[model samples]
Target: MTCTIFYTTAMPNDRAQVSGTAPRKPMRWAVEYLIKTPDGRTLVESTKTIQRATFEELRAIMDHIIGAIGDEAGNIASFVSWRATARGGRSKRRARR
Candidate 1:
């Protein structure tokens, strides 16, 4: 199994900016992870928007996710989408077992 992670910054629209306030950092950051089989079929996709934060912190989180996927590559099909977990989908123990 192979996994790819994609992420980008989301800028706020003019309406979100205050006339007098300093420009806000990006409205949020969008992150996505795509889990695929060796042949290139997408098995699962997860996306999330996180509030602005320090680069180190964000990088740490991204590293953690990538590490996790690598650790679980052998059983990738049993992995659940991160988005689904946020929405109260199957728990990790149940998903794997």
Candidate 2:
């Protein structure tokens, strides 16, 4: 199996800022975890949406995924949506595995 990590910075609500109230800080981050088979079919996904996550919380999520999926979790295929960035090293890691 392969693990894919999708994460982005949380955005503050606009309404709070427009209402002249202090905008509540959103969780520092948001993330989705997915596991896929070698043939490109999704196996399982996180049921709970992580819209607000601290760095520690994200790490905990990663740990859980790793425990569930084994060492394959260490070879993550990460994509950063905000920056339109994708890691090029995923193929190398997959090859190693």
Candidate 3:
């Protein structure tokens, strides 16, 4: 089996607003990962958000996750399905509110 892993970082916009009167918190960044099969099918895709101060920590975490997934091909589908179920649950809860 062949696969490719892609990573990207997203920076927060300058005009973001917070809900309270307190000063806005430091910028938080998002690290996104995309795992794709040889035929261009996406196996797993997810993003992890972290404060700027923890950028290096987030990078390390991303590297670990990528390494583990690369070492275990069989777990890709399971990860994707689990994410789907979790996402569905969140959406259902939002819809009920």
Number of the top lDDT candidate: 1
State residue 33's C-alpha deviation in candidate 2, in Å. Answer: 2.2
By TM-score, the candidates rank as: 1, 3, 2
The sequence of per-residue lDDT tens digits that candidate 1 reaches over residues 20-76 is 222223223346565554545564544566665333355566557656775777644
lDDT of 2 at 71: 51
Candidate 2 structure quality by residue, lDDT tens digits, 1-68: 12234333233431111112221332433234445444454444434444554433555655565455
**Residue-by-residue lDDT tens digits, candidate 3, 1-97:** 1112223322244222222122123234444555655455675454554444232343465556666876776444322211100011111235555
**TM-score of predicted model 2?**
0.29
> Can you give the lDDT of residue 79 in candidate 1?
28
Q: How many backbone clashes does candidate 2 have?
A: 0
Q: Quote the lDDT for 58 in model 1.
A: 51
lDDT order of candidates, top first: 1, 3, 2
Off by over 4 Å in 3: 1-31, 47-53, 74-97
lDDT of 3 at 32: 52
Deviation (Å) of 30 in candidate 2:
5.8
Model 2 misplaced regions, further than 4 Å: 1-31, 44-47, 50-53, 70-97
